[model samples]
Target: MEWNISGQDFVTFSRFVGAALAMGLAAIGSAMGIGLAATGALKSMVRQPERQGEFVRTMFISQAVAESTAIYGLVVAMLLLFTTGGGHTDGIHGSDWVNGLRFLAAGLTMGLGAIGAGYGIGIAGTHAIEAITQRPEMSGVFMRTMFLGMAITESPAIYALVISMILIFVMGAPDAVGVFSGNIMDIARYVGAGLAMGAGAIGAAIGIGTAAAKALVAIARQPAKQGPLVRTMFLSMAITESPAIYALVVSSILIFVFTPTDAEAARIFGGMDLVAIGKYMGGAIAIGFGTIGAGIGLGIAGGGALDGISRNPRKESSLVRTMFLSMAITESPAIYALVISLILLFVFAVPDTMSWAQGWAELAKLLGGGIAIGLGTIGAGAGVGIAGLGGLIGISRRPQKEGAMLRTMFIGMGVTESPTIYALVVSLILLFVASSDVSTMSQGLHDFARFLGAGFAMGAGAIGPGLGIGLATRDALTSMAKQPAHEGALVRTMFLGMAVTESTAIYALVVSLILLFAVG
Candidate 1:
């Protein structure tokens, strides 16, 4: 153990690990995307046995586009393997751990970023094939839509790639340049940035693809309305992209703004500024995990609007109005996440004086609040989408009662959002009220547990009821559409069901409050 740094080429070893992660994770999404393309194309060929060649051609094209993200990852892996950009040229030393983690973060960023984009492109291809099968004459329009959707879906992956390349070619830690470089805090920020970009890409890409897929179907159903449909699709996808944008913003802030200068790293060795660590880490987690559900929800709502438009083209204006409303509400959870992230990043500062244990307590508090809002909103966002889509479908069928149907939709979404609201409350308490100045290690640890326990207790608690309430209200809206004469009965019954479904979120809030206020 006391031997010199001659035991292992740690730098090379770390690069190899990074290479493995980049290619290995990228392979999964690309393979699945390719498989999805093949699956859909094959099914379409079977249905229209004579058009196999055309289907195969489009399938290959889609597969090719989907493969690009993996290709990007491959290039990153190769660079890491050969140490192409730059690295410790001297024989690998033990102090290369910071550089090692930086490269690891790079791989993770590219690998995770490719997943949703690849799969989403494949989804677009699948639906594109279906559109071709249904309306062979307008294959060109469908292809265009498919490609456009795929391109937009790839945006998040592109962001990830940029960050990955930056990590490889520009930034470093072992050969410390920034104040924060080569420190624990720098490592946390780098890793958090990776996660923020990578995971944030998932829901947004899928949502955009969902919209594209449905728009293709709508075009096939109503070619005369293609112009309107395409416009709606563009608007929907634009909004859906914001979640990834929020993640990107957080990633950029972490990488570019809050770095440690070389002087700072030299002066302070292992001074655990837990607040700064929490700021980067917690903010990343908030935007990264929080945007996922909202993006999916927005996509679902958008897709439903396309479906409704195709079904009742005569009511396009009304349906589009409803679509806008639905999307706005569905996107709120991501907004909440962005707000929390901004607050964490800009509002909190490392205290001037504190015990080391007190720092840990602060770290836990920030993380808990971030986790609370991040995970809590997922189910609520998706649930609201479910309800919104159901209401849209119902309105398409019964436009005469649009007013009543929309009222129900509003109530449903309002209730669906309660869980997120509850989580927000807990997060605020942690941010503003939770104690982090305890001098004793025991009290500090206690505060840490209390903060995290409340964060998790409420965040995880609100998820199920949010989705459950949304589903129940969806059916209620549909049922009302079917039997408008019995609207009274349906509305009352839906209220009761949703209230019961919401009880679980209430229980979670109670537990969170108890953790925050009653825990020793």
Candidate 2:
């Protein structure tokens, strides 16, 4: 077969050219936006040197936001220009049209998302600057608020990237190929989708720099408020870069989602048919949801900790310790989510589900395991709640003692939450580890896996009680702190009460460990 390249496919070339023009426009937009924001802040600072701190902070944030639209456009434009999958040969014009339309959609999505993020950050940062100017002492609070606001604003951008990626790869590539009976342009669409998201790297870089500059200025103006300011900056940056993470996600989707469709796949790959789709879908779901769960859980944990710190400034050390403990516990839910996802990837999504004997049985086992992982979140939440509540109470009573007590509490709380971790580990192993001669040669390993799972289920269920007892301990400590003269008697009684409360968590761990190792 001889394939001839034709210049008549000017439509594809034109689309690429349009993408370049868009990129240039976007750069101009960013430059204008940045210049406008910076000039305003600089002029304000010149008019009022005392307000320099405020203006600088505001400028940094505004510039970051302002530059977003241009960056997004640039990303889309680049995608269009660079992504031409395989060598192009003369093909039907309809395919070129599809590719062109897809690129346009991608450009629009990125552009809109960037604009939204920019506006959001500008509004929030401006308010924060004004607040700081009025009350320099409250800079910490203002910064934290600013970060949160910026994060929220960036969400739309993330959504845009996600949509753009889908349009370019999932919808565009396949449809273009179908319309034109498989042309180079179709492949180009997929590659372009990935390239479009690469712009996220630029956004992230600029965002981080902006955040750092703001933080530095804030610190320079108010050294005492440095701790809170740093924390706020970290959080804001995390949120800001979230859009970039989405870009990464979209890129990944683009790579996999456009795989030859069912009909085409059969014609090209020639396998058991339905098996591939199931496996791919299952794996996608598993990884997608699992990581999402962790991210959400962590976000909640971080927010709660931040709130606790802000509310009890004197007890920051204790609050921080509690935060760490809470985050660790919170991570359990994500671990379960991961376990479920991994199972989808490894077990449920197997290339040939029915190839093994008793296909239905294998399916049941895989699905049941995933469900168990998801359910594990309940226990993780309970454990974190317990530790968080107790830590808060302790810090509230004796702010000065927060540091010592916090460390102790976290260690104890971590130990208390150990069983949940063990459960997650076992679940992952089952999901990923191949079932083979080991099952036949040594029932111990196989039996241990199942036993451990049951132990984890029970162990996870017990986290609530464990937390309740910890909270009770905090109450007792608070009571004793109020009356130091009678501390001995209270201490003795508190220990007794704590011991009783701890018994349940202990029992759960013991049982889980025994099940995990000794039973077989």
TM-score of each: 0.92, 0.44
TM-score of decoy 2: 0.44
Q: How many steric overlaps are in each model, in order?
A: 8, 2
Q: Name every residue pair that clashes in candidate 2.
A: 85-188, 286-341
lDDT of 2 at 149: 48
Cα error, residue 175 of model 2, in Å, equals 7.7
What are the per-residue Cα lDDT tens digits for candidate 1 across 130-218?
99999999998888888898899888888889988888777766454333323766777888888888888888888888888889999
Please write out the lDDT profile of model 2 over residues 1-520, one tens digit for every residue. Answer: 8655332254455456547655654555356556655665666666678878767877787677666666666766776667663223455444555455556646544653454345434544544554465566676665665565455545545555566656555564343332332333234334334332433333333343344434444444455666885676576457534434644554455455445445442232212222333233323333322233233333334444444454555566655566566556545554455445444544443242132223322332343344334333334434444445455555655566666456545654554444445445544544455242222323433553544354345435454544454455445545644664565675567567657765665665566455544655
How far in Å is the alpha carbon of 72 misplaced in model 1? Answer: 2.7
Of candidate 2, the 10-residue stretch with the lowest lDDT total is 265-274
**Residue 352 of candidate 2: its Cα lDDT?**
27
Q: What's the residue-level lDDT of 108 in candidate 1?
A: 84
Error of 1 at 313 (Å): 1.4
Note the residue pairs that clash in candidate 1: 178-260, 178-261, 178-262, 179-260, 179-261, 179-262, 180-260, 180-261
